[model samples]
Target: SGALTRVKTRFYHSGVLSHCVRVLSLSPSRLRGIWASAATLAHLTSSCCVGAEPGSRSEAFHRLFLPSVVDVLLSLAGQLMSRSEAPPLLRTVMDAVGWLLSAHPHLTAQVLSSAHYEQIQMSDDVTRSETHHTTSCLPEDFLSQLNDESALLLLNDAVAQLALSSDAAVGGASIRLMSDSQRSFDVSAGLDSLLEKDWRGRGFEQEVDQLIAMPRPFRLSRRRRRSHS
Candidate 1:
């Protein structure tokens, strides 16, 4: 009886769904298997219905895929965050987070709102650990350019863009570094000094003089009256 067999399969799937929810809810570590199972199911279902006509069943299958896909993406994000070599792979992870965010708002909100704070804090701890092991870590070229104020401004701008645009993959340590850099902003000190040197007798000087010659808004009323005859 084809109808009887279909009814049995439906009951089996329903039972599996209940078990999956229980596992996902109770144990955080249990999430690793969730992605594997969800992926397998999606693959199987997609293959089975490839030739089936478009109808209610296809719509239901797609609706079910949404939550399962979100779960897998979120779990993967958390797993990557815990890895030791995050820096070397940071760009790759950021791209993944951006991709996930575009497709899954619920997952994006969960990561961006609550999970990101802890993720960043842990990354800061890792960076600090690395710094303690080395006396002088930066390259010689970086050290040489460090004294040039313009170079520092350029470096700050580059890091700032990475911090603002990067998603879950960028982690907390990278963001903390950016924040620390922002707090240390001193245009008068580093790159600012270089800009001042280059701009000494250039158009910058002429622009400054022009600005000085310009009347203040308060003086505009008097200038208007004088010009009116």
Candidate 2:
């Protein structure tokens, strides 16, 4: 009775809860008290359910929340893939992936690519910060997390699209927009230096040594400067 009431209430509201629940169902995490509610939502997203459309209110809400949800799902897929566990959850996760690719084809590539690189970059940062006693200039892992393969493809295609549309300036403009935040990404620049060194083919043994020898840049705040005098 209470469960059906919850489902009915969600039906009149948002679709995100339902989709997330579908994810949780396949998840090994054993979420408590919400499974029934989630199943109710998934029931609605099904083909037999009424009123699902690309530009409808429900779809808008899906777009708003779905990206973040997909990020979680991608992370789940990576974890499952890593562990070689192709359970029922994999099918559900694949369903979510298909939905993402179909509904947001333009964004799908970028999102996945960003997720992959973000994970690698974050693990690298954690190792660097803890082991080397360094401060990272990167924002919390969320900002650069958008650099995934799908997003990169979308970006590259977008560049092509811009050229096709005869708007080459858009690509340069995007780069300019990023340069607006240059100071904050200096650590990324430092990492770029290290990576490029390895690509030159003679620095295998000395890559880490060179990285270790590099100076960490210090940022001077106005308040710190004021305190000194």
Cand. 2 TM to true fold: 0.33
Q: What is the TM-score of each candidate against the true structure?
A: 0.27, 0.33
Q: What are the per-residue Cα lDDT tens digits for candidate 1 across 1-229?
A: 5565465346334554334334434333654545444333433332322222324454543355434433533344345455555433332333333343333333333433334323443455343233211111222233232333433443343333233432322222232332223223322223223324332354344433432333344223333545765
- Among the numbered candidates, top lDDT falls to 2
Superposed by TM-score, candidate 2 places the C-alpha of residue 104 at a distance from the truth, in angstroms, of 2.6
**lDDT of candidate 2 over 161-217, digit per residue (tens):** 222222223323323223222122223334334334422243233533443344444
Displacement of the residue 20 alpha carbon in candidate 2, Å: 3.1
Q: Against the hidden true structure, what lDDT does model 2 obtain? A: 0.38
